[model samples]
Target: MEFQLDKINPTKAIDLYRGMLKPRVIENKMLTLLRQGKISKWFSGIGQEAIAAGVMQNLNNDEYVLPMHRNLGVFTSREIPLYRLFEQWQGKANGFTKGRDRSFHFGTQEYHVVGMISHLGPQLGVADGIALAHKLRNEKKLTAVFTGEGGTSEGDFHEALNVASVWQLPVLFCVENNGYGLSTPTNEQYNCENIADRGVGYGMESHIIDGNNVVEVFTKMKEITESVRENPRPILIEFKTFRRRGHEEASGTKYVPEDLMAYWEKRDPIENYEKALMDADLLTKDDQKKFTDEFNEEIKTHLKKANNAPPIESSIEKELADVYQNFEPKNLPASTETNHIRFVDAISEALKMAMQKNHNLVIMGQDVADYGGVFKITEGFVDEFGKERVRNTPICESAIVSAAMGLSINKMKAVVEMQFGDFVSSGFNPIVNYLAKIHYRWNQNADVVVRMPCGAGVGAGPFHSQTNEAWFTKTPGLKVVYPAFADDAKGLLISAIEDPNPVMFFEHKALYRSQRSDVPTNYYTTELGKANLLKEGSQISLITFGAGVHWALDVLENNPDLSVDLIDLRSLSPLDTEAILSSVRKTGKALILQEDTSFGGVASDISALISKHCFESLDGPVETVTSLPTPVPFAGQLEDQFLAKSRLEKALIDLANY
Candidate 1:
C-alpha cells in the first residue's frame, strides 16, 4: 500500500505530540516510583513511545486498544488518569484494578481498552474480536493490539493474525520491534527479517516504520487505520525501535553491550521527535518547556486525586461480574429427573438443551458438525440443528476461537471444541483475550463455550495428552469447569452454554467413556459460582473438582474410618469461597487434591483462601496432594503414578495422622 501524505491533516501533528508527551511523563514517574520502592513493579515504554502514540493517535476514542505491558504511551494518549496508573503500580485500592491486577495489568473498559498486560500474543486475538464486534454492529471503530517483536513466536500471535486475515476484521496489529526482548535480541528470537513480513503469509497488508520517528509512525498508522476502516481488512504494523531499559524493575541492563546501547541511545524517540517538531517550525524551545510544565502540573493533580480516592472496599465484588448478565436463574431439574447416561452423551444432551433454549447458540471447530466431533460428543448435531448453528469449521484452532469471539459479540452462543484439549494451545489467544474480556470490557457478554478434552490416561501422547487447566486458572474473567460425573457434565455444560460469558469446559477424556451417572433428562441449570458438597464429614474437608473429584470420593468410600467432607469445585474462576469456608468450618481440616501439577495450580488458591478466611478454625494445616510438576508419561504405569487417586489416598492417610 502506498502512503498518501496530502490526505493527512497537518493539525494532527500537534495533537500527536501532546499525546506522546503525556506517556513519556507517566513512564518517567513510574520508573522513579519503582526506584524509590513506592511501587513494587513496572514496565517501561521509554524508548518506544512513538509507536504507542502513533497507533493510538490514529484510533478514535470509541475504538479499542488491547495492549501488552509496554503500552503506557497508548493509554496515556487516551488520557487515562496518570495518578490512577501510578496507584496501580503502588498496589493501592484506589488503583485501576483496586489491587486485583498487577501494576502492568491495569486497563479501563470505559475507554474501550480491552485486554491489559497478560502474557504476550493473547491481545491480538482480542483486538480481532473487538473489531469483529464493530463490524457486526455496523459500527465504525477499529481495534489496535500492541505487542513486542518477541511475542511473534507465541502460538497466539500466528493464531490471531491468521483469523483476522481470514475474517477481514478491522484490526491493526502494532508490533513494537524494540531490537531486543528482555535480554534476547529479535534476530535470534525470530527468523523473519521483519515481523511485518509474517502478515504477507496471512494475505494482509503490512507496514514497517522507523518507530522512533513520530511523524513516520503516526503517518504510517493513519494510512493503515484508514484502510482498515474503509475495507475492514486487518493490517500488520512493525514498529522498529529499541528498549532503553530492562524488562522490569528487577531486571539488569548489563546483558546488553555498551556499543549497542549507545548506538540506540542516539535514536531516542522523545529527543528525535522534539527535534523533528523544532526543525519543522511546529514547536519551539519555549513551547516545549511550557508543554512540559503544564503536563507535570496535570500529573501532580492526577496523583493527588488518585491517592485520595477511596480504596476498593470489596476485592470480590467484580469477582463474578462477567460470569453472566441479563440472564434469569432457572431452577434445577427435579431429583427424580434422573436416567443412567454416559459423560459424552450427557455433554451432547446439554448442548441440545442449550441450543433449543437460545437461538444465539452455535457449534463449530474441526469435525465438530458433519463429523460429529472426534469423540462423537457433537454427533448428529449438524443434521438436527442445520448448518448455520452447527458449523463445520476449518482445522484452525486460532481461527475457531477468533470467529467464536465474533459470534459471541453478536450475542451468539458459540460452542467451540478442540478435537482434544492439547490442541487448544493453537487457539489460546482468543480464549484468554476476546472471549474472556469481551463482557469485562465493553460490558458486551460473550456466551462462548470452549469444549476441551483434557487430562491423561487415554494413552494420547505428549501432543494429545496434556492438561493445561492450571495455565488458565490465573486468568480473570474466564470460567473453567471440569466435570467429574455425567450429572455435572450435563448440568455444568448446560449452565456454561446458557451463561453470558466465555467458559473453558474441560471434559476429561478418561471419564468420557469410563464414567456413567444418572443425569437429569429434563432441562436444568447449575450455579456458576457454587461448589457441590457430595459427602459431609468432620475429620477433614477433601477439596477437589473435575476428574479428581472421583478420587476424593473413592478415598472417602474406601477408607470409611477416614471421615472426609468432599467439596466439588464446579467453577474454578469465582471458586465458591463461601462453600469452601463453610466446609472448612464444619470439617476443621482441609486437603486440596488435583490432577494438575502442584506448582501454580488450583491447590494454591484453595490453600490461600483457607489461610485468609478460615485459619483459626483448622484442626491441622491445610494439605495439598497433586501431580508432581512434570509432563504426563505415555506409559500406563507411569500415568497411574501421576493420577490423583494415589495422591489423594496418601494425603488422606497423612491428614488422619495429623
Candidate 2:
C-alpha cells in the first residue's frame, strides 16, 4: 500500500480527526475526574490516539476489535454513546459490565469489541480464534488486536503470531510501540529493531508506520485490513508512538526521560493530525473549536447523567444472577438397547453425533485430525467432519484455549483437547481468568469444552498423567464433568457440548480402554450437576468420581458382605450436594475418595460440605482416601504408592467398621 496523503478523501480525513479528537477530549475529562476521586483509575492514551482512531475508522461494524485499556479511540470511533461509557467509568448498574468490571476491561458484542484483560497477551490468541471462526464461515471479516510494544515479549504473543500465520487466519496484529511497558523502556523489552520485524519470523506481511500521523495509520491499515479480509492471512503493523502519560494516572512518569517526553509532546498525534487536516483544507480552526465544544458538552451531559445513576448496589442481585446460565438437568429416558464400547469410543461417538447435530461445532487439538489424537480418542474424526471442523493446532495451549473463547464470541462451540491433563497448566490463564470469568464480567457466554486426558496408571509421569480436575472445580463459571462409565461419558460429553458455558471434561487416561459399558449408539444427553448412585447399601456412603469410582467398585466386589452406598459425582463445579448428603444421611457414615492428592483436592471440599450439612447424621468423623501429595512417578511401584488404591481399601474397612 502506497502512502499518498493527497489521495485521502476529505470526509475520511475529517472522520479520522474527529476519532482522534474525541478520545483526547474524553481522556482529559477522565483524568480530571480521577483527580477529583470521581472515577477510580485512568489509563491515558493521549499521545497515541492516532493508531486506534485511524485503524478503527476503517473497520466495519461486523469486524471485531480487541482493544487494550489505552485504546479509548476504539470505543469512540465505533460510536459507542458517551453516556454508556460514562456509566461504565462510574461503576453504575447500567454500564456494559453492569459494574462487574471497571474501565475498558469489558467486551461488548453490540459494538463488536472484545475487551482485554490485565494479562495483555492472552487476547492475541483470542483474536486467532475469532479470525479462525470468520475463516471457517467464509465471512469476509477480520479481527484486529492491539498490544503495547512491551507485550511482544510475552510467550502468548509469539504463539499467537505463529499460529495465525500457520493457519493463515484473518487477523491484524496492531502493535503500538510506545517505547515502554509500565516502567521498563524498549531497550530492556526486546533487542529487535522493530516489532514488525518479528512478523517475518512468522512468515507474515509486516509494516512500520508513523503512529503520530493519523493519515498514515489510517491509510496503511485501510490497505492492510482490505488485503487481509480478501486473502485471509495475518499481518503485523508497528505504530511508532510515545506515551505522554504514565501507565495509569496513579503511576507517575518519574522514570520517563524529560527530553524524550518533550520530543513526543511536539509530535503529539492529535495536534499533528489536526494540522494535517487543516493543511489539506478539510478542517478549520473554527470547525475544530465547534467540534471540541460539542464533545465537551456531550461529556458533561453524559457525566452528569452517569453520576446521578444508581451505583452497583442497586443492581447487585441482577449482576450476581447473570453470573451463570441456569441450565436445569434434563431427565431424558435411558436407552434400552445398547452396544458395549470403550470409554474413549463413547466420547468419540458423542463428538461425532454432536458435530452432526450442530454444524458449527469444532474440535481442535494437536494431531487430532489425521493422527487420531495422542490417545486415538478422535480416530476417524477428520474423515467424517473434514479439516475445517477437526482443526489441528500448533503446540500452543494458551493460544488454543483462548481461541476457543473467541469461537464462542461468534456463537460457535469449540472443543479443545489438552493432549494430557497436566498441559492445562499451560492454558490456565485463559481458562480461569478469561473463559471462566467472561460471562460474569461482561455477560458473554464462553461456549468451550476442554477435554483433559487425566489421571495416572499409564506410567506417563507427572507431565502427561495428572488428575487435576480439582484445580478447575474450585473456579466458578466452569462446569467440571468427570464420567466413570462409557455410557455416562457419552451422555455427559454431549451435554457439555450443548452447554452455553465453559466446561472442563476430564477423561481418565487409564479408563480410556479399560472401562467398558453398554452405551447407546443413538444421541442422548446426560444431566450435569447430578450424581449417579451405582450401588445402594446402609453401612457406609462412598463418595467419589472418575477413576475413584472403579476403585470403590472393585472393593465392593471383593467384599460382598460390605454394605456400601457408592456415589459417582459426574459434575464437580455444580456439586451434587443433595445426592452426597442423602447417601451420607442414610449410611450415617461417609468416605470421600479421590485420585487427586488430599491437600486442596475435591475430596477435602466434599468432606467439609458433609461435615457442615450432615454433622448430626454422622455416627463418627467423615473419612477421606486420596493419593499422596507427591508428583506422579514413572516407575510402576512408585506410581502405585502415589495412587489411592491401597489406602482407599484400608480407609473403606476402617470407616465400615466404625
Candidate 3:
C-alpha cells in the first residue's frame, strides 16, 4: 500500500488520517464522560473508524447514509457539528430530536444521515427505500447502510437485501464483521466463511475488504459507490475488522483473549495510518501534537457547552403531541347522487385518488402490480400508473413496510399492502416499534398507510385470516382504522394519506367484493377519531367495527321489537369515546362486538371504557360478543363454529329480554 502511495498526494494522506482520527478522539472524549458518570453508556467504534471515514468521504452529499450504533465516525465525517453530537449526549432541546430521543439515536435529514435504531436490520430496507426514491426521481445518488455481522442473521436483513436485489435498488450493504455479535464469536454465529457469501443468495454482488486499512477501504468503497449510483443495484461488502473495546462501557473486554486484544491493538486503524503517514513524510510529530492540542481544547469547549445546555425535556404530555396528523375536519358533501360500487372498487378509488393527487405516493405489496393483489382490489392500477409507482414486491413483508417508513420520512408517502393482515406479524417489529414510534419519539412522521386485508369467517386458515386491530390498538402512536362502509373506506383512506402519521388500515376481506353501497364520487374526508351512527335506538347501543358492524346490525334489524343503536367505530386507536359514551348514555345498555378473539381484544378496551364512563347508565353488565380464543381453523365448519355468531344472537336475545 505504501508503494501505491506514490500516486496519492500528501493532502489525500492527511485527509484519510484525519478521518480515522476524529472519531477516535470523539470516542475517547465520550468514554471519559462515561467514566465520570456524565453519560450512562458508551458504544465505541475505536477499531472501525476507517470503514465509515472511507465511505463518507466518497459518497455524494445527496446520497443517504444509514449508520449503525458503532458508525459514529460516519456521523462525524458527514460534518455534523461536534457540539451537536455533545448536545445529543447531554440531551439538549437543540439536538436533532429536540429532546425527544435521549441518546445517540437521532439523525439529520439535511445531511442525509439516519442514526441507528436498536434493531439495526430494519434500517437496511429504509436505506433501500431512499435509494428507490432516487431511482424514481432519476436522481444520480445511492444510499449506503451499515450493520454488524450478526445483524445479517435477522429475518429483516434477508428480507431487505432480497427486496433491494430484486428491484436493483442502489443500496450498499456493509457488514462490519468485528468478529463478535456482542460476546458471541463469528465462528459460533454462522457456518459461512464470510457474511458476504450470503449476498450471492440474494443475487447481489459480494466483496470482502480489509477494513483496518484506510486506503484500501476508501479506494474500494468509492469505486463501488460510483458504479452503484450509475447502474442501480445493491452490493454487499464484508469489512473484516475486530472490536478493540467491549460492547459498551459496562461490559469490559474480559471476554476477549489477551493475545487477540494485543493483535487488534497493533493493527488499530488510526495508529497504523499515523505511522504510515510519518513514513511517507505526509505527517510529522509537530502535526500530530497540533491535532492533539486542538482536539483537547475543542473537547473541553463542547463538553462545557453541552453540560450547561438544558437536559432533554420529557413528560407524558409531550409524548402525545404530534402523534397524529394535524388536519381540520372537513365533512362530505351531502347529495343524493352517488355511484353504486363494490368495497374493493371503493378502496381502489381511494388509492387512485390519493396517488393522482400526490405523485410522491407509491404503492407496494405482493402481486399488486400485475395481479392487482390477491383479492384483485388493485386491478388495473398498474395500467393506470406505471410499475414504478405500483410495485409488485417479493414476499418480504418487513422490508415492504420498513421501506415505506423510509419513503415517508422523506417527502414521499407510501401505501403498503399486507396481502393478508395476519401476515403482518412477520413485519410487526418495524411497524410497531420503529414506524409507530417515529413521530412520538422524534417528531418524524412516517406518513405510511399500511393496507391490511383483515378478518376471518371465510376459512383462509390461521396464517391468512386474522383481525389484528387489538395488537395495533395496544401500541401508542399508531392510528388503527377499520371502516364498515365503502363510503367511509374511501374517505378514511384519503384522510390517512393526507395525514402525516403511520396508519394501520384494516379492510375486511369478507366485504371486498361482497359488500356494495352508493359511495360518494366527489372528494371528501371522514374525520378520524370519530364514529358513524349507523342506526338510532333507545334500548341498546351496538358498538362495533369492521365486519362485526354488519353482523351486529343484521342481528338487531330483523328484530324490529328490539330497538338498538349501531355505532360504527371507524377509528380504533383514537377510540370514539365521545360517540360511544353518548350512545350508551341514551340507550342505557352497551354491546361491544368485534371479529377479533374475545380475550384481550379491541372490544375489551371499549367495554372497560364504557363500564368506567357509563356504568351508572348500564341496565345489565356490559356485554361483549367476539370470536372464541383459537386459531382460525381451516375447516369451514370449525371456523364458523369458532366464530360466535350464534352466541352473539343468544346474547342479543338475553339482553333484549333483560
Per-model root-mean-square deviation over C-alphas:
6.5, 1.7, 1.7
> Per-residue CA lDDT of candidate 1, range 1-658, in tens?
1222244455776677777787787667767877887667777778787787777877888787778888777677777777767667656665665565675664565676654535666656656656766775677778887888888888778878887787677888888888778889877898867889987799988888988877788777777788778778888888888888888858968988899999889988778767766776777999888988888898888878876777656545565653345576576764676889888888988888878887667787777777888898778877778765676665678767876765554445678888889888877766776566555443567678889898887777667877788767777768888778888888888888877777898898888888999887887877777888898888888888877887777767788898778888887876788999998988889899888877888898889999889988988999988886778788888888876666778778888788
The alpha-carbon deviation from the true structure for residue 636 of candidate 1, after best TM-score superposition, in angstroms, is 9.6
lDDT of each candidate versus the true structure: 0.77, 0.90, 0.85
Give the TM-score of each candidate.
Answer: 0.72, 0.98, 0.97
Off by over 4 Å in 1: 1-7, 28-42, 135-140, 248-281, 284-286, 308-329, 332-343, 356-364, 379-414, 422-448, 454-488, 500-522, 527-658
Most accurate candidate by lDDT:
2
| Per-residue alpha-carbon lDDT of candidate 2 for residues 111-226, written as tens digits (9 for 90 to 100) | 99999999999999999999999999999999999999988999999989999999999999999999889999999989878889988789999999999888888887888888
> What tens-digit string does per-residue lDDT give for candidate 3 at 1-658?
2324554677877888888777888788888878988788888889889898888888977778888888888877788777788777666766777766656587677787887789878888898788888888888788888899889888889999999999898889989999888899988889999899998798899999889988888888878988887888999999999988888868878888999999988888888888888887888999998887777788788778877887676777665665654556556553466899989888998898888888999999999998999888788988888899999998888988889988876678899999999889988999988888777566677889999998887878988888888899999889999998898898899888888788999999989888898998877788788898988988888888888888886777777788888899999978889999999999888888888888999888889999999888989879999898998888988888877565787887788778
lDDT of 1 at 312: 54
Task: Give residue 520's lDDT in candidate 1 (0 to 100).
Answer: 79
Instruction: Candidate 1: give the clashing pairs.
Output: none
> lDDT: which is higher, 1 or 3?
3
Q: What is the lDDT of residue 481 in candidate 2?
A: 96
lDDT of 3 at 282: 82
